[model samples]
Target chain A: MATPVLTVKGLTKNFGKLCAVNQINLQVNQGEVFGMLGPNGSGKTTTLGMLMGVVNPTAGEFSWFGQPPTHHIRKKIGAVLEHPIFYPYLSGQKNLELNATIKQTDFNNIAKVLDIVELTARRNDAYKTYSLGMKQRLAIASALLNDPTVLILDEPTNGLDPMGIAEIRTIIKRIAADGKTIILASHLLDEVQKVCTHFAILRKGNLVHSGPVDDVGKGEEIVEVIAFHDDLPAHLNQFQGTKEVKKDGQFYLVKMNNGFHSAELNRFLFEKGIVVSHLATQKKSLEKQFLEILAENNTH
Target chain B: MLHLLKIDLKKLTSYRTFWVVCGLYFITLGFTTASGMEFLKWLANKSVEFGATININRIPLYHFPDIWQNVIFVSGFFKLILAFMVVISVTNEFTYRTIRQNIIDGMSRTEFLLSKMLTNVLLSLLSCAMLLIIILITGFIYSPEIIWSEIFTDAGFMFAYFLEMFSFLSYTLMLGLLIQRSGLTIVVLCLSHMLEAIIKANIDDVTPGLIPFFPMESITNLVEMPFARYAFQEIQDYVSLTSVAIALGWLVIFNYISYLKLKKSDL
Candidate 1:
């Protein structure tokens, strides 16, 4: 059994009359890349803020490692919220030294983290003089200094170019490979699909969908089959496993019912003596599934 | 607490504005105290040359017992410069959002506030040390003789000056926490100072004894105007325990309110 790293129950946050985060419960386990997927104003940052102990929750509570949340507990969890926050007038090295001071970690770790972020060459430059991508990298280096068991990053690649985003994702993947639990919040579906082992989606402060990334579009199967015989499309409609079939030119798009597999379909067609010219199966894209989830739970 | 102080010093030592403001305060306080007598003698000479027949040199401004009060009272004006430094430092935490970062990095809100308070204590102690050195130098150079017993007789005024500096910095710290914008905080500080003076003046007209209870007035009363003795007029020659207690009470009140503000706010 996997050990639970973080458990949040009935977590809610309301700014005056506007509820920023509704009653939401979530649990993340050890060595899992948990992605918090949401659009703008969906309270992703607010939830992370509360977990970091910077924002007060309106209702409910959370714990780290099955213990109550406290500042001391936070030392075991590293986090970056919204944007990179550091003294602009101080050098990247100096800022990390200050963060190290606050965390009571060894100053020797600063050099190692900076080297991991590939910022060792420019560590002495003032923070304000660095580019946005460099600033984000420095934040990651600071987060890594504590050697935290769980690293939380909100929008780790929010405003970066394509190359910058790739660089951050590579670093995240490298860290996650070390058996550390990571909680990453981002609106990019592609990012979550690529890096996260599990994900939860939020819409307008409400949790709409959550589960393992592998479980997405798992129940049903869709197959595209083409045959030289024109009657193949007609035969597909009568198959017990077939839910719906649409013809496009010479190919028949078969939507299989729940629990149906492409092998069963091929077997059924072979028994019918229908030779197919082409056969392919496609799992639903996460982008389509995500949009469908949001569309299904569009109560707000 | 020492660790918190170290963290704050690291944040401050690399910032140019912090050094600039501290340097400005050091020079202002050092120059004003060191050259005060010469400036007065120059003015006395100009008046003599102008046929005004004034003999300002006869006044013993740097006398051993009186020098403590004289030096401390003059240093009060420069304390506001230090107050501005406190304001800028505290407000920069907000402007840069480092306060939020600090809290996220395993620091409690109380720890964060305590770190800033520690900085205040450090600044106050430094100011006092500079004052002690300058006052001793000035007293030994100009006094007729160094009476070891009398040299520190008026040193209670130095304690009062410390209370004055510390409590005043606490007041500015509260202001910085309340108003996160440095420029706006300074503006509010100045406006409130004027407003407090006006209120104190009006309150003195009806209840003269109650004026010392106000926050700013209480701090100011800790170091009462000692220059009145220069004109041979009556003055409170030493620190009063009642005034010290009042200032101490206000200091506690200011720090408590600041703590509440930091605790309740969503940094």
Candidate 2:
């Protein structure tokens, strides 16, 4: 495997008496869209802030590209923490120019990045005059100015309209498709599950669960069926490749082995003289898994 | 360092209030110097007798060695106008949160503090150069035959004026750092005058000789009042070395506070 683009070990931060971030260890490798998922106040922002060098870590250490944390190292990485940070007086192009200057990058790329964000037309408008979505777009555009290999975004879609959120997600996914390592922190589990290739769940500054997004709830293709009559799901285990079956209030959750699918199950149920009224092949959503992870961690 | 200042200048040049206040400072410098010269010319015409028959123009107020003190002392009053620019520049980063953005963009805390100090130095140099040109034109316009040798006589006051600006900027920067809002910072700055007065009154009441040693007071004392000499009143004849040292000391302290705050605090 390639070297980890970001290696955070025992990263913790405390705001006086409140431990904003406890010991959290995480590693994000190159070209992987790694999402830090948690609910509000779960320290997702603080962890991202500490990684971006905005909030000083009370304990532990982190590094970018195997080098110590320094301005030079930071120049290689692009990030936007909790808020959309820009001088509102400047034009969109001017704000990106400022970012380019800070990174010691070329000003020529400002046009290209503006185009990427679909903000080339509004490039001359002052940042204050832009809408809220435009401001967030501008922030992401600035983060892309240096053509950084690693992008860190904290709640990129927070407070954005649906259109704005879709636009940002498209841009982010495009960048990720281009083989850039993206470290995103969000409370939206669906967003993370959709955009990220790997994920880590944070609860009160602790890593509850983390792995490949595809690895979540693997080895089971559960199907939920609702029928007009009762006593039909009790014989579901008699079907071939059935692992387990359970019923919960007007729905039957059939845990099937790898060989069975919803179509096969429907045909067998029909052959068994049972008529199906509703059948939905259950796709285990990250939201359910995330809440389960949080609930389990809470009990411990 | 130049790159860091370039990073700062990129933002500063785009900042409107920076240029507005800067324009105000130079304009005020020109208007005040011209008005001072014009008023002195008016006094020369009025032939107003201060005691009995002495004309104000005959008092050598615009002469070479004396012109330095007169110009610098008046120009120093306009430091507030320029100091407000510094206040805005520093607070702009905080209010807009560009400082945190800049830090995330690749500027370290020390580089951030240094960029501001460098801008303060740049402003000091620019303002002092403008002051020099104004003094030269006004002095040559009103005074007798130029004695090239006496040009450097009161030049120390000119240097003192630059230090005074640099140090005052440091103080204003500290205020900006401590209070992040522009409107609030300005209010606190204005209120600080009375605040300083109260503190200095209480402190100086116990130690009689320490009032001149105050931070802002020492900066203001760098160039003694030149217009007051027109009233036939006594002033600090020479630039007080003690005051300059104290002002420089305060400058170091203010910058230290700014750096420490930026370094230690989570932006």
Candidate 3:
């Protein structure tokens, strides 16, 4: 694994008496796209704000590249908490230039970042004239101006249309591919699933799960075997590695305990006089894993 | 700090409303100067018909000079208008939620506060310069006999006026930061300006020397008074300087408290 670019330990934030963020621990590795998934007011924004140093933490500490919130380390971080608020009367290029001034970044990089967000053509237009997606893109451009090592985004695709979402996702993926750490906070499960390699599921300000995306749901890979079964075929038992068998309507569901070859299973069943109707592998989605986590928490 | 100042100046100049406000200031100043000049001319003619030996040269001294005095008057009024503009500049970031973004982008709370102060100071200085130029032109046109020395002396007082205006600007900026509402800030500023005016009008009579201590009043005194007033204009000069100091003292206190409040408050 790459070095941890961002480490958030025991992060907590309280708004008045309400605990907006409970003890949440997370980390973003260098060159990894980490996703923070939670519902509205679920402390995603609060957590991001704390990490960005805009919102003070009630408790806990976060470090960037092993350095705490110091001037040198903070310069390496760029963030977009919510909407991209700019001087509405100023053009997009001008807004980015102001951000550059604040960040002490090169003003010439404005066009490059604009082009990265596919907003090069709209650079001269006033910010108020941009569409919702375009505005979000401009915000992303502002964040990228410093070529920051860690880009923290809160709902980067929140209000974007389908096409805009796809575009932003592509841009973010490209940025991550360039070896920069990207931390995205979003409620869109599919967006998290598609874009994030590492995932942190936050619930009520607490981190429910944190690990690689593949390891979120850690059970045996279940392969659904659907066939027109009037009765359980003797050939089904001929399959050697099948762990458990269950009936779903007219189909038989087979859970694989180990690496069971679907082709071998099908061939073995066919040779034993069983007619196969359908067969496919099933993988649990991040949403399903998230809901299961929530269900388990509710039960406890 | 210089970079922050540059960004502020850029943002200030980018606002169309600023240009509109500046235009309004010039129109108001021009009209007030023309009207005041005409009224002085009429007053001079009446004094001559009455055989009171009214001298045109004395008219520039005893009566208000057409250019310098009018510039002072107009700029005083313009300060009230600029108060609203300054409030909008500071509070709009909060109202629009832009400060949050700025902070997240690595701008410290102190830097943000400093940026607004820098912008306010720049605007105040710009207004002061405009007032000076307008008065010089007004004097050159209508009150040619007006003592250039008096105008030059008063011009030096603009630095003091700038400081006073900056104190009020700082106070207003702090209010905007605290309330985070442009409308409320404007209302408070307007009420405060009115209260200061009333206090200034009654200062010599009631307080005996307290009027010059008020923030806006100190700026007015600095602009409207003769240079010799500092040494011989009763105790009012000493009181006025004290007022300017008090205003500046409040500015420091307000800014310090505001810095703490802003540092603690969530953007």
Which predicted model would earn the best lDDT?
Answer: 1
How far residue A162's Cα lies from its native spot in candidate 2, in Å, is 3.1
Model 2 agreement with the true structure over B1-267: per-residue lDDT tens digits: 888778778888987777887898899788887577567566656664633465555767678878888878878778888878877888888778788888888888898899889999899999889988888887888778798998778888878988999999889999999988888888887777788889997887689698987887888888888767767888776888888889989999999999888888998
Query: Number of the top candidate by DockQ?
Result: 1
Q: For model 1, how does the per-residue alpha-carbon lDDT over A130-169 read when each residue is reduced to its tens digit? A: 9999999999999999999999999989899999999999
Angstrom error at residue B117, model 2: 1.1
| Candidate 1 lDDT over residue span B1-267, tens digit each | 899999889988988888999999999999898887898878877777633665555667888988988889889889888888899899999999999999999999989889888999999999999999999999998888788999999998878988898999999999999999999999988787789889988888799888878888888888888888766799998789999999999999999999999988888
Per residue, candidate 3 scores C-alpha lDDT tens digits across B1-267 of 787889677787888987887678667755664465566577777777633554444444323233343345445655666777778888878876878777776678888889888888787877777666656665666554556555454344556667757877788888888888988888887787687777667666767666556665555555454433323453222224655566667779878977998889877
Model 1 off-target regions past 4 Å?
A1-3, A225-235, A246-253, A266-278, B49-52, B202-209
Sort all candidates by DockQ, best to worst. 1, 2, 3
- Which candidate order results from sorting by lDDT in descending order? 1, 2, 3
Whichever of 1 and 2 has more lDDT, that candidate is 1
Q: 2 or 3, which is superior by DockQ? A: 2
Task: Candidate 2: give the clashing pairs.
Answer: none
lDDT of 2 at B180: 87
